[model samples]
Target: MSISNGIGNLQGLSNPVTPASATVQTGKEEQIKSSVSLAPGAVKTTPVTDQTVISSTSELLTRALSGSDVRLDKIQPLQAAIAAGTYQVSSSDLADKLITSLLK
Candidate 1:
């Protein structure tokens, strides 16, 4: 199965290819919106109701990460250790992990 971003391009769909900006020939009120199927039983047909777009990548990431919580309880101890010059780094372990990740 193929996946599409579905925001605009519809080159290979079984459904009629309609660009998001396609104007309705008969009506001024409705514009033809495209439906993209990422996989079989993946994309469900929802009513063409509203069109909302994220302004930018940063804005999209900000909105996506907005409601997430930071674990200050864990971070505070790490910060304290670093500040007091007690934080230890295992060079061999770090090298091993870095090599393993590169292999993957």
Candidate 2:
């Protein structure tokens, strides 16, 4: 089974490679969209229609806002992309934090 940082049916799967495989094909309208599967019951072919990407993002956000430890391996690529300038942080967010800190 395949897992993303926020989404997927996961179905008690613990390993990466098996008789089955899943890959995430992230996109614009859909951020961390997953595609590709394998084997008989391989990737738990649930539509994931009920679960929007927003739900997934919100779940991860709830964990973050709670200050819980997250799986770093799941986030390493994003960190690298940001560091490499392939990704960006909005100036609005940065400025908001700076102003909030000054007010505090």
Candidate 3:
């Protein structure tokens, strides 16, 4: 056995009421003007200047990242050791560094 629910009858699913278009009418012509006037003493004008001060730490970092202080010779071996799973960390050294950073 089979049943037909008339799912193809889209006319029954549509809205029966239609919306009417709205019309707006306006009668008057007016001119709008905006103006601002400041008294002589009301406004204070000072020379605008901008200044930037780099911290010593940031300057050091920038210098380091400029590739001048990078020791690729030392880093390449460390990277290779790490990739080979043979890199080792000294417990005392690691603890000392952790404490130093925490203190900072």
Candidate 4:
């Protein structure tokens, strides 16, 4: 098998190099470019508008607390029904549940 040589052998290339002038454009020197709009409807996105914007962290906390407190109040009736022995539980269903618990 023949061994191949790499870019290491092509060293010291470009015998003559001439210095060239560089151009740098400043903000003021930059040209203002405009494109011809052919589309009838172009998407124009306005800045994000929050229907419900929490002004402060405390305000957000108050709003969340209000909703959670209302939901917690609903569990009171279910708790009362179970405590008053009004909640009907079948014997066979109870035995099945116990058997399921024992199997687990």
Candidate 5:
């Protein structure tokens, strides 16, 4: 077969077929309507209020801290020593505390 004849047959096959138009009847459609209404006393709503209560332990802790003395001069020296890696803990004391806690 000739190449031109084969290409022409392919071009004719590639042409799209036209689809038929759909027919619709009008002026006979039905419509639906809906609504909702509540009676005067149907839903009763009360005013909402928020309250907060502090526990006795929390109140005591707040009062204790407020009246306590914080020795910053002593604390600053210890903090500096710890930051400089010069603060040392006794191994005997640490082991004793660890064993005590473990036993408890």
Candidate 6:
């Protein structure tokens, strides 16, 4: 078999570009712009109508994140009691709490 090539092979193919029709309008309306003339030394302030409020949970979380995880009020008394050799903890209660945390 021999290869054939010529413009005759492309006779049925349509042109890729399309020309615009005369019925379509191409003109656009001109927009009118005016300048504002304010009095001398006049200041314009925009009024704010919306305000953002922080939820209680978000405020508490922000405070907790900024402050230490350990509370000073709870830790101070415990530290003092331990230093005075009066701090007592039950073994069963501590073990139960540990096991409960592990299960969770």
Q: Which candidate is the best by TM-score?
A: 3
Answer with 2 or 4, whichever has the higher TM-score.
Answer: 2
Ranking by TM-score: 3, 6, 1, 5, 2, 4
TM-score of 2: 0.28
lDDT of 4 at 59: 88
lDDT of 5 by residue, 1-104 (tens): 64564535534543332322222334334111111223334564567999999999999999998984978889999999999999999999999999999999
lDDT for every model?
0.71, 0.65, 0.64, 0.59, 0.64, 0.66
Which ranking of candidates, highest lDDT first? 1, 6, 2, 3, 5, 4
Better of 1 and 5 by TM-score: 1
Summarize candidate 2's per-residue lDDT along 1-104 as a digit string, tens digits.
95588546567555434332244335643322333324445565566556435678898888889995778887998999988989877999999999999999
Per-residue lDDT for 19-97 in model 3, tens only? Answer: 2222222432211111222333456466899999889999888877886666799999999999999999999999999
Residue runs of model 2 more than 4 Å from their true location after superposition: 1-68
Backbone clashes counted, model 2 = 0
Best by lDDT: 1
lDDT of 1: 0.71
**TM-score per candidate, in order?**
0.34, 0.28, 0.35, 0.28, 0.33, 0.34
Candidate 1: regions farther than 4 A off: 1-65
Backbone clashes per model, in order?
0, 0, 0, 0, 0, 0
Task: Write one digit per residue (lDDT tens) for candidate 1, span 1-104.
Answer: 97777766655655654555563455533433333424534665768898887679979888889966888899999999999999998999999999999999
Q: Write down the lDDT that model 2 would get.
A: 0.65
Better of 2 and 5 by lDDT: 2
After superposition of all CA atoms, the RMSD between model 2 and the true structure is 28.9
lDDT of 3: 0.64
